[model samples]
Target: MSDKLTKQSIEETFRELSNWGRWGEEDEVGTLNNVRPEDIVAAAGLIRRGKVFGLGVPLDQPLQSVPHKRWNTIHTFMQDGADVATGMFEGRLQYADDAINLPTHSSTHWDALAHVFNDGRMYNGHDARRFGSKGFPVNGIEKMANRMVGRGVLLDVARFKGVDSLEDEYAITNAELDACAAAQGVEIRAGDFVLIRTGYQERFWSRGDWAGHTTGMAPGLHFESCYWLKEKDVAAVAADNYAVEARPAEGEGFSYPWHGVVIPAMGLTMGEMFYLRELAADCAQDGVYEFFFCAPPLNLPGGSGSPINPQAIK
Candidate 1:
């Protein structure tokens, strides 16, 4: 906390709390080491109601163009013709396919440890030179694909604050997170996929104002939450917001400090732009806050991040 929100503080925290050598000097999977195979077995016990909810935002064609330089995904829909050509498949075997081209940090995506770098260093002190102009030479998103499965706990901050969704520029603090946990009667344990819902995206969906949602001010995670997350030893943290941290940033002359610290420093992957309204509603209706959370990133080798189709089973 001495370094506070400055780049100096981020460096200090990385030196103090990094899992760089805990796994290995050659380790690419950072805090994902906290996720054990047995964690999945125990997570299955949370499936009493046998309900499943997807967390991916629907990626449709000609996605909304937003300000601040972060636009929606581009999905080109296509189909196989019923008329057969030379060397074509047999009749009645036509299908559909879509080619998607977007930023790796697209809707409902996972930010790999290499997503951010500091001073020519990546997670665990890996050299940024390892990252080629094409993609990551190490610590790729594929390394995290299988490692991102485990228990998920939702802290619905909007509901806790007596609002359908929090106002723009609201940054969630550790105290607010604690209050949500207390209200749900759940203790955040190690190896949990801690998901915080700000309810911003869903409200935008109702009004069809993705432009306003994406370009305008919004809620996000407090930088202090990074320290709390590292202390708690969670496998990863995800959110319903785009950057997962508030903007314009709380730190003076520092923008998106937590992304630099948490992904590159703490070695934790962050999920963003999730569709958590249904899951939040389900949890509230049944009063079950924790669930079997399972989300494996797409196996794109050398990818810094991947669009993920996450799910919560309860």
Candidate 2:
């Protein structure tokens, strides 16, 4: 065969063997967009200047279902020869602390990519390699670091319903999210860290059996909603509930399918149990949803998740 014919034959043979004709190649999704790296850095500056708002719950607050072992502590002691000076320390200095066992399945926590799997794969096509002596790759809290300084938009769902709180076990739907944003005059943007306040943050601790009283997104998170947010390129989706997705995903017979969709397929992160009472109050007073938001997770390698202190600046 001529040189050109030989090349064409090879290409055709490879395509036939690989079934390339039936496959659609698309661009892989990344974590930086509507909120750029520079944007997050700038937002950090605003937070330092105190021009932002805080949206995280106090670490010491009894907002989680941590085992009793993990509670932090302080100790004071003096150097042997330094006038017996007293110093302070916290956390279980000598023993392992387990009090803050990340709910991994409950309210107000970030789900690592290892947290779920769809078609048997984790984020960035990481497979069983995600699990090891340490844990899942990109599935732990470490991958969620430096998440501050995105354009955050709030969806005040409760306010739209004229109620301070939604019914227990309430699941937020795509329509509600859209309506809430519309009421607040905010537009969803790519790379925006979306914050949905179900007004449950206010009742935390006060509610008997703290975990039981919480609300969540309703079962059906409309695939279209996930598609929309993914298309917009959000870094993460957050809410005031424990799980970012509603319980009992549509016909899936399980809760928090949003985790599967956002994390693995879309490579998006989910933030839950965010404190929004103060942030909501400020937004209500200011009548705006655009703010500089920042969240830096504790750097704990191989940790399933980390305690986050996220803030939002106007």
* lDDT values for all models: 0.80, 0.57
Residue range 104-198, candidate 1, lDDT tens digits: 67567898887788667798888887567788868889998778778899999999899988878788888999989999898898888999999
Model 1: pairs clashing at backbone N, Cα or C within 3 Å: 3-9, 169-218
TM-score per candidate, chains pooled: 0.90, 0.69
Which tens-of-lDDT digit does each residue in 32-74 have in candidate 2? 3246677666545434335556666655455544444333322
The reply for model 2, stretches above 4 Å from the true place, is: 1-29, 41-52, 65-108, 137-140, 208-224, 248-250
CA-only RMSD, every prediction: 3.0, 11.4
Error of 2 at 273 (Å): 0.4
Best by TM-score: 1
Question: Who wins the lDDT comparison?
Answer: 1
- State, as a TM-score between 0 and 1, how close model 1 is to the true structure: 0.90
